[model samples]
Target: MLLETHVLQDTDPDLPALLADGFEVVGESWGAEFVIDGGAESTASLERLRGFVETARAAGLEIRELDARDAAAIESLDAESWVDVPTTPATVHVPVSALDVRDWATRGRRAFGALDGDRLVGLCVGAAGDNDFVVVAPDQRGRGIGGAVVAAWMLGAIEAGERSFSAGGALQNARSLAMIRAVGFRVTERWLSLQRP
Candidate 1:
């Protein structure tokens, strides 16, 4: 005996449009960056995105990672103290998914926390990738915490067999640029992004 199965097709016009052209609505994502599927969009889409990147670059933004220990302190610092400053939507929050210490530990990535007498004052998260350490955090600003965190992370990365560490900062963010410079991370690339219309 043989059995046949039939799959019902979606009736929504947008569904077909999206599927036929490989377009899909993006969900809310956490972290420093989000990926978009453009499908069959025209050059105009690329142009618009480029314009957005240019504008954001003009606004001064920065991106870099802290040591795992400092990354762990982010939650405590934000919870215990008050920081009076404006944070970019992209820069202020870390995804809960990335904070799974157990998973990171299993994968050989170390998570570290800075302490102020048993209270965590800063945290850092670093991963081994492309022979470099990728760090992420939100509290590495003011009071030289950023540099300290990166220094720790770099040492860990070196011990883990990474020969070099790389990071990025926006042209507009003076504080972040200064912190990265203080830690001796040279500029390697300029990044930009845009949302679809």
Candidate 2:
């Protein structure tokens, strides 16, 4: 799946090479960033995300950083969530393994989840860098869980000295786009996907 696994910049030298190899544009994904210290606009964006977190808490969703114990549940949730999703832009980031989840939990405080009782109902996490990938369970969506987990993760990221945050997804993914925008990120980079037809 290397054909679709990457998002290439508009000026990437590999664009010509891929085209020469019979690859054609199949889809596009956009990259967005939030400048933590950008002043009033930044404050307003952060307020929105913080508000979502408050809403989630009022609804009794517990947002916390993931540890090793959350690995299995998060992995299971990701695998199951993908089963019903119909190939959205974020699908490229799916099928997260337990090992990877553990790595994120054990390394930087990058992975976080929203819990409903003992069940992990939402997740937002990334590697050692910015918290990029996020997913909320199908049944638990629309109640601000996605935004809450992301907000929780970003709060931690900022505490850990992450001055700016980045996120990306398919160009057509309105759900993910809406969530990111609710925070403070702006579309800063866009890249296309090309694959063999």
Name the top TM-score candidate: 2
TM-scores, each model vs. reference: 0.47, 0.82
Which lDDT value does model 1 have at 101? 46
Q: Which lDDT tens digits does candidate 2 get at residues 121-154?
A: 9988875446657888888878888889888888
Q: Candidate 1 lDDT, tens digit per residue, 149-185?
A: 4555555555566654445433455665665565544
Output the TM-score of candidate 2: 0.82
Cα deviation in Å at residue 83, candidate 2?
Answer: 2.5
- How much lDDT does candidate 1 score? 0.41
Give the clash count for model 1. 21
Window of ten residues with lowest summed lDDT in model 1: 27-36
Please tell me which predicted candidate would have the highest lDDT against the true structure.
Answer: 2
CA-RMSD of model 2: 3.3
